[model samples]
Target: MSSRSILLTGASGFLGSVLLRRLSTLEGNSVVAAYRSGKDEGDCASGVLSLGPIDGNTDWSDAWARPVNLVIHAAARVHVMSESEGDPLAAFRKVNVDGTLNLARQAANAGVKRFIFISSIKVNGESTPLGKPYTADDTPAPLDPYGISKHEAEQGLLALAVATGMEVVIIRPVLIYGPGVKANMRSMMWWLCRGVPLPLGAIDNRRSLVAVDNLVDLILTCLEHPAAANQVFLAGDGEDVSTTGLLRRMGASLGHPARLLKVPSGLLQQVAGWAGKEAVAQRLLGTLQVDIEKNRRLLGWSPPVTLNQGLLSTARHFLESDQT
Candidate 1:
């Protein structure tokens, strides 16, 4: 964490962009921005490099402009709602697994001290029984292409760490939400802001979520903490909220009523099955909590932002963005 040069991948992405800004502003930290496509006009990094279409064969010769102290690999083939690929697992492996190993090997060769991988909670299976939250020690049971790819990448990174002595820190975060969040979290916010009546009021299941800022804080901690090396840490806000509670909080933050109907969870699941939206229903009603006790005990780290604060920030951003 001293005066060191850091190379950051996916610098223009949602979470990555916020990390880029924060890393760039820190005194004595020189940040190199790496993106896959067009240049990020708002990038404040000292160095910018384009890594077009990451895969097994990406040429990363330009990433090492200086002696890099760390590499935060945030780029990957993320999960999509409607996958267009003919072979989704193969496609994900090419990028998330192969692309990650390719970069890590190169970073090790270049004498990079540490490599931080942003993994997902999906690596620990889909859902947990209400109170039995997933721990970092849980057996990995990735069900989808994206999660499998991440699990493979993590295994590869650990092997590379042993072989090359480059510290590997893997972080599995659950449902990260904050300003500029997209996908389902954003969609939920949109529904709340519009006062749409949702049938999720009766959901009593627990879901753990981490704010983007909180995840970034943990990443920064891992970058320097000695106890973080070669360790897998689960990240969350440390507060589990039911779907109904989440909607209500978001509604309050957005200055709107959730307007949620007290529909029974069983009936909703049945209806979702009939509509071929069982996957969506499971996410809305099922339990997917992660235990962050390892994070607290090892790194003395707790989420810097509370759930309410995070939701309020996200809601304010949504309102401001909608106006513009």
Candidate 2:
């Protein structure tokens, strides 16, 4: 692969920050890291050329004055609380759909070679019916606004690729966990660290999570690998960890024994739903697994970091951060 200038959206996000750090250390690669607001101090450390608040109207001709070889669209409005109460479709479409098209249009005009989109497994569905795991070939039947928006964006991207002849690679990754994570993941770490007794021990639901390091590795491989061009791939660690098993491993990583009360799964679900946290309960107690054999066979990619290693590193970061 030729040394190329890459434009990375969502440079301040969890996955994007890690990718920026990795990209900075590589020689002969120039990165244009875009963020919606605020400057990421880490960008300076990573030597990324930072661009802020870029929208559909923002003139990217200046940034693309030189040849841009790749564009990684990682920016999107992720899942949030109360999808029913808000117009999440508009919110997600603004950034995930319109914003993506804006960048892709400019990149295509600039003669960019590959456009790698960091999509989510939610595009498949909120939950897999019965016992089947979602595959790359599954029809998109997104349940939430965030998922719908991403699916729409995928369609737009493929359409743009067809019209402009730019290679497009869409990566739909499951729950991604790593150091410096926030939201639900951070909450899980907090509970484990405090030894909060969770009722999830009884739940036997299986979910797939990818380590940030492994996800970044796959992104880099896709950047240059010929097989990745104009393809959609589902990415995960290939191991399905049950909620009980996940908390147990997390406890080990946090230097604490698992403090769990094996409660009835049905009762817990009812209570969680009644408390208006059905989404949270479903994610924690329900099964949403993915099969990644396609990624392994097609790209010859495997997770470089194990689940234990990733969990340990994440726990340590939280531990150290809490002290400071």
Candidate 3:
């Protein structure tokens, strides 16, 4: 294959950084990595372009000089529970919905061959019942502003594809964890390292998570595949783990004792609700799974790395980082 020009958004972020590194290694890819700040042209990617606050009015002529072969959109206004912004939905829609559609319009006008969008499983809702994991066929019922914007983006992109002849692929991934992971999962790692005994040993809630690398692999798989056009796929490590089981695995990787003790799930939930930590309680005691058979059947993809392998990599990074 000949060299193909690809434009990637959010190259400075968590998943974006990992995707940038992977795309840069491709033999015939002319990668144009877009970021908001912190890197000048050629600083990180050979063709790094600064995207100054994406919105409907954002210009793309300066970024894509030539028709792009592909575009991997990873940027979005991620929800921060303590966000300073007063209106969360407006904030999310400004970027995730409007800005994303703006990018799609530009890509379509520029004759981009394919556009791969990174979405979230939160679009399907917070959790699924035990033994009844969510699948792509489920109608989106987003509960949060972030998920709502992403679902809207998905709809907008699909419509844009129909109107402009641009192929679009949508990927919805659950909690993505790998080296340098942050947020709730990272907090668990921190507590484990500090020898904090968790009261979740007997908790049987199952959660599905994808390693960053695994999610990236799926993105790459969808980027060039004809079958991925106008398709929505879910991604996970294909390993369903209980809360206690996952913590134990991470503890093993960190060389620390999980120090897990049995606690009643109901009591845990009640205390957490009383303490204004209901979300945390639900995650620690709920089952959230995804059926990724579509990814396997259609894309012929499998998680290249095992869940334990991904967890160990994350643990190693935690140990090696300044946080330790």
Candidate 4:
């Protein structure tokens, strides 16, 4: 086996930053860390390049200079405020779809061996049922512009792969949580730290969340695994948790008791509607999970970090970061 050079975009993101650090430790591989802005302080990779903006016009020559063998595209337009947008889909397509395809095309042209795309579980619809979970083979039914763009990008990548013979691997991850996490996960941590009395104790919904370390492990597994070639995988920590269950676990990790009130899910929804938080209500009350057995069976991989361990690490980071 020859030494391979990898171009990793979004190296500054929460998951991407961790992925970059882990990839840097590979014995014989060269990892190029590309970020839109901000420096990666812990970066000890072969090269670190500043990508001004990851749009269609962005140049990949610097990243591909060393005969890049693999391209891990983790940067994407994940958040799109559709209501305030004039052309939300088009805006999303510019970065998620067009920009992604552009980068994949460049990778193919540069003789890159594999293109690994980090997508979202939104491509498999919003939520799952009580017993049923999402699978890789399920038909895509993206309900939002962000998901729609990702699904389109997946299609484009497949087409590009067929035309250029570049192996493409897509991994769709659900809510990823770990140290340096942001968005809803971060909000949850903040609320927990402050001892907010959340009324989610009665909400019995199972959601699948992946730890950053586990997700990075899966990404690394897909990089060189022959069985993962041209495959779509659902990334998860394998253990599902309910709202109250997760709160309890996270609270323990933060060394705080979970201050939760038992409120009916229906009443919560009604109150959320009155307070103009229907989306938040649905998310809090919904069950979103995926079946990762296929990823285990096919690639012989499993989440290395247990959910509680990961949560502990996340909580520690949050408390430490806040004090800094």
- Taking the tens digit of each residue's C-alpha lDDT, what string does model 4 give over 211-271? 9999999999999899998899999999999988999999998988789999998899999
Query: Would you estimate the TM-scores of all the predictions?
Result: 0.98, 0.94, 0.97, 0.95
Better of 1 and 2 by lDDT: 1
Q: Write the residue-wise lDDT of candidate 1 on 58-148 in tens digits.
A: 8787887578989999998888878899999999999999999999999998899999999999899999998899999899999999999
Ranking by lDDT: 1, 3, 4, 2
Query: Per-residue CA lDDT of candidate 2, range 1-324, in tens?
Result: 357788887888889889988987788788877766456556433234455554556566765865678888888777777555466688788878887889889889989999999999999988875468999989999987889989998999999989999999999999898888888778887877777888887888888899999899999999989998888988888788888999899888888778999998899989988998888888888898888878888999888888889888988988888523
Best by lDDT: 1
Task: State the displacement of the C-alpha of residue 287, model 2, in Å, after optimal TM-score superposition.
Answer: 0.4
Query: How would you order the candidates by TM-score, starting with the best?
Result: 1, 3, 4, 2
Q: Candidate 3: where is the Cα deviation over 4 Å?
A: 39-44, 322-324
- The 10-residue segment with the lowest total lDDT in model 1: 35-44
Error of 2 at 139 (Å): 0.7
- State the displacement of the C-alpha of residue 145, model 4, in Å, after optimal TM-score superposition: 0.4
Q: What does candidate 3's lDDT look like per residue over 1-324, in tens digits?
A: 568788989887889999888988888878888888665344446586776889888888876785577999998999675668788899899999999999999888888989999999989999999989999879999998999999999999999999999999999999989999988888999999999988999998899999999999999888788789999999899989999999999999999979998988899999999999887787789999999998889888899999999999999999999265
Model 1 spans > 4 angstroms off: 39-41
Task: List the pairs of residues colliding in candidate 2.
Answer: none
**Number of the top TM-score candidate:** 1
